[model samples]
Target: MSVPTVDLLALCTTIKAWGRELGFAELRITDVDLQHAESGLQAWLDAGHHGQMDYMAAHGLKRARPNELVPGTLRVISARMDYLPRDTATDWRARETARLADPAAAVISVYARGRDYHKVLRARLQQLADRIAAEIGEFGYRVFTDSAPVMEVELGNRAGLGWRGKHTLLLSREAGSMFFLGELFIDLPLPVDAPVSTHCGACTACIDICPTQAILGPYRLDARRCISYLTIELKGSIPLELRALIGNRIYGCDDCQTVCPWNKFAQRAVLPDFDARHGLGSADLVTLFGWTEAQFDQIMAGSPIRRIGHERWLRNVAVGLGNALRAAPSEALVAALQTRIDHPSALVREHVLWALAEATERS
Candidate 1:
């Protein structure tokens, strides 16, 4: 057997350039070893901070060890793609705040409003990998985007992509936390980039603005209290204690990112894939709650929001309606909850009843 030689130094330069051409905001290389992240991962699982996201702990140490996850892995090509729409207005953050205040408007996460990023990033990353293979003559590589056991934030942090913010998401001085991270694990011995130093300083804007106080402290998050987990991840019932605090957030919540001071510099996506679809950015709560399972499946055909399915989707919207009712009782909001009171899913029916109760008590 003959050893295939590679010019690693030049390969690193070529890979980054190709990544930029592939619509990635930035790309950096890092070694596969994640020994530094293992303890933190274990500690989080130990504390049960992951809630019902059993997948987070299911992969065990493979989540921290890329070499174990994909044998023979040497380097991880971490790529960042900013997800904000290219046409996002300058006052977008203010607009988000205003929407939240409206009580009747449904607030889906900006990221989920677009095409499923998993589909977009995975396909693009595969292209990036194939392009590398074409240049380097076949390489051992597997691309991942928010998939499997890989710890993307740690990889992105070590690859000099960004520092992990107080809310436990990667935030770049140039890109904030509004970006998708993908990794191309390869056996090539590419030169590694130095990690970016933490710049969160004493600023606690993200923590202060967290609707559920999901951020226990800097770099510490309790996902159980997180609205995103309650709405999207938890399958059974939402804890009643946190329902009111969830407010009008029907999908994922972005209060932390929206309030972050560094987010002023957040970059918009180079590709149009993330542009808000179906008017999700300004959708009314009653409107989203009225979506039949078929309507949800059809309209969210290519959206990440569909992952929660119409059942959880209704559950979340019901919570938002409950909050809206308490904020100010309205016949439209009450009527919407009544329509779902007999929903086929027990979970949806349970939430619908609660939403109606909120209106009853408040009125």
Candidate 2:
């Protein structure tokens, strides 16, 4: 159904206003065309850079073609939500690096330390879409947050949300890259926003700082070597060669964002949903190590950490513990691995054995 010409501009205006009310910091609309990103995506998939993320390749060109994926999708309404906790310690990155240096400290990614964003973002996007339906009557639209084959970052850039940074993350002059992106694909013909100019301009801080050199070059990242993909996405044994490079990052890595100059301007989420939960912001490894499978489920019930499951969580923490043991032998660190020495999960047991050996070698 053709949208009335008179309602086009009004629809965009109302959407942006309602988005702010829903606690999204920024909103922009983009056309369904993503031909430009298609080639790059194909190349990345062809090179097997996505590792075991078969879904990325499975989507094919549907990821770039919005209307094809969602019938009648004429435009994409892109939104960004800032996630930095307002009260996060001043030297957060420094503290994380120090934790890597120390063997006993367990380092969880800053983003996963809080509630899961999938539920938070998906709910908000649905609310935003629902409100739009109220204003414009029932419409054909679908809300997505890190779901399916959506080219979220490309849409964000096309809608003028921000430029894709050298680290392959969306970065905004106003809010940096410490944010989550969601999309609302609608059949209405909304005016698309022009993309902003990139500002990386000779800065390679993220590339130089990546512990695994995941950033192969500006605007290119090999997910196979990324710590985040390694710890959370990859389900098999932690590659021994890259295990040492994983450092103390157990859940995910934010070093690229933490080191980016633009993130200094990253804003805090207007909604408290994104705030740190359960003191995960500064949790001790041994303390996290002691959590039983039941405790892990209970504490991480509504958090993103739960998606990795107890076994993978233990596997990652074991890698961190091994690295820590190598750096500074500690009875406490060894003991933590010992407790899990006979874990039923082979994944966890293998990592624990490796960590114990590392501690013994250090001693």
Candidate 3:
């Protein structure tokens, strides 16, 4: 039995509609020729800008060649979902600024406080692809969300969803940059979207505001020195020199994104899955430090924070505590450091001891 081929234009239209129905903010498609992007990617890798994330180098040119990584891929459908928390009080950048100064405050990146975006985006993208498959009758496809080896930002830009910002994140006039990106690679040859013009003209807010100077140039990031990369992606002991610059950002940092003037236009997520849970958006360092391993698991389940596990969580919290101690050394801070003095994980205890010494020095 032959499955009649579906019209490519019709399929693209249907996929876009289905994506909207499934809660994606925008959907765009592009052909798989990333020749223009290859040089930038090669340069980034050659400079070791990826830090300890060797997979970026290991994938080599395959990162830019979608069809090579996913055989028979002809079109890539890129989708964006806005993730700003709704019904917030004052500006988030102001809050993050306060957290940086307080030291006793725990600052998790705004994106990681809610449910894991990987799970949220993958499920929605799969459902969108499944709906297309039902109509087209068994098309070859693969869905990806923050998955390895896919040049997602490049694909999103090529698909006309947005242009890559100076910080290397995809940004749109309509969507700003507070969003998650996902991809659906299909064998069907869909019409490609035209790229949009760059709007980050002469804007160095993200570059200048980065505490670690991670944004080396316009659209170039040295992930090795990025706080987000240092705290979350770099699995080993964080380099001692970078620890103080990390400030109170325990899990991930949002300094660059928070300072972007374009982010004022950032949209709130339509899906409830992204709403902040466990009061994480406003949690204090001491409160989070008081959590037992079981409490940590219970509180962080379904959140991206779970991936770092308890040891790293404590290690991060210790850094925040250390900063807090320096900012306002107190008996409470001393007790917290002492409680974790003999923590089971050497990594946790090491950071705690360093934090205690820092607190003592401040006193």
Best by TM-score: 1
User: In candidate 3, what are the lDDT values of residues 1-363, reduced to their tens digit?
Assistant: 233476878877888888899999999999999988899899888888888898888878998999999988988999999887765544766777777676667888989878999999999999987788778788788999988799999999999999999999998998788899999988887888898999999989999999889888888889999999888888778888888888889888888888888887788889888889998878888888989999999888899999888888888888888877877888998897899999888898889988898977866
Q: Which stretches of candidate 1 lie over 4 Å from their true place?
A: 1-3
- The local distance difference test score of each candidate is 0.91, 0.87, 0.87
Worst 10 residues of 3 by lDDT: 1-10
TM-score of 1: 0.98
Candidate 2 accuracy as lDDT: 0.87
Indicate which candidate wins on lDDT.
Answer: 1
lDDT of 2 by residue, 78-161 (tens): 999988876767676677677666666677777777778889888989998888877767878999999789988999999999
62-130 per-residue lDDT for model 1 (tens digits)? 999999999888889999999998889998899999999999999989999899999999999999888
Clashes, model 2:
1
Name the TM-score of candidate 3. 0.96
Candidate with more favorable, higher TM-score: 1 or 2: 1
Candidate 3: the clashing residue pairs are: 103-324, 104-324
Q: What are the models' TM-scores?
A: 0.98, 0.97, 0.96
